[model samples]
Target: MRDPAPRAVTSICRALAEQIERGLLTAGSQLPAERKLSEVFDTTRITLREALGQLESQGLIYREERRGWFVSPARVAYNPLVRTHFHAMVAEQGRVPATEVLSARLMPASADICELLQLPGLSSVYQIRRARRIDGRLVLYVEHYLNPAYFPGILAFDLTRSLTELYASEYDIRYGRVRFDMVPTALHNEAATALKVAVGGPALRIVRVNRDQHGRLIDCDMEFWRHDALHVSVEVPD
Candidate 1:
């Protein structure tokens, strides 16, 4: 927009947001380049940019690394303690779910990991890194740390699938008590890089510690999710 008035800026932002809400723009669709959008909207680049910033802040759009802006996906309402796997939950929502196994290795447990799992002595822990996508969009990356003693020779198994299923079949393990600690944060380092967001983009960190029927820690899961990708809700029975 070359000489747009203030009203035009507000209108443009609102119009785009409505398009997103109505699925006219569709989730994960890239917006036209700045020059093209400016031309189409009959506005100056400055005005168009202002509207884009508004959309970004409202969680209606997001920018990717080396990529242009795209409409943000509808937030998934996550049941933090659900027994259902990610794939099932996603399918029930009419979205395709996929998981990529980044890496799996056994490493000497750090003091932090040991503390979180209540390990009394230094021991090795099996760590697996996974990135989960819904509708072909990368939304969450999680690192799972497990006590190697409970999973002897675990590296030989196919780890790309659900770990919960593996536990039930392999060791007859079932979840007992679980603890969750979550916080809003800015993505950084590998989490930001894997998620295709900037280093400082807003994100959420969910830490889950799961125990088995014997009251022994099964694993500690650290999950990093795109801020706009999930709307977390928990149902508690008092």
Candidate 2:
């Protein structure tokens, strides 16, 4: 027999969650009033309110004082200290991961790229642009710049594969340390298009500079993600 007390609330929450996940209830869509939801689920008003509260805590819905509830946009979390690749992170969350390679080429380093990589003027750099997805939803736009000498034939490698793993297995290039800076930003046209958000949508811009075991700059990467899609966490040891 099903447990009766929480069943009704859970059912309502699950139905709403499924609709949100399947895009039937889109972001910013206003949910029905509590009475309507209770009637729809054949439950009491208190139970319906509990279900809405649960969804709100999961970042799936928001309640306004007088406006009822609206769908909360999706979000993702990023950890700078983790050494794993993007694919691994998404996989660990049981979300599908995919990448669209926008551009990859060998080019002379721009001044900023040269400075970040500590390369001399005119040194070759492998520049790659990719759009990342989670469960078929566009989420991140990334641009990576690498020292060509440190990662030859990188452009030819399967980019969807883990770059860190490829470097470790093939060239013994491993990240010994990483530095990250984050800032709030508004999505630009290209980033908005890649991330499937409107222009001026809130974003978290992360810039990472990774160094190899030898203390040489290995890669400089910039990532832009929808602000609603991610959470960041750090655990401290006692």
**Whose TM-score is greatest here?**
1
Evaluated at residue 185, the lDDT of candidate 1 is: 87
Misplaced by over 4 Å in model 1 are 1-9, 42-50
RMSD, each candidate, Å? 2.3, 9.4
The best candidate by lDDT is 1
- How do the predictions measure up, each by TM-score? 0.89, 0.70
- Residues 1-238, model 1: lDDT tens digits: 2445587689889888888888899988999898998888788888888898788877899888888899998888899768777888889888889999888999988898999998866778999999999888889999999998898887789887788888899888888899999999888788988888789878889999989999998799999988888888989989
Superposition TM-score, candidate 2 onto the true structure: 0.70
Clash total of candidate 1? 4
The lDDT per prediction is 0.87, 0.81
Q: What is the lDDT of residue 65 in candidate 1?
A: 82
Q: For candidate 2, what is the lDDT?
A: 0.81
The deviation in Å at residue 66 for candidate 2 is: 30
TM-score of 1: 0.89
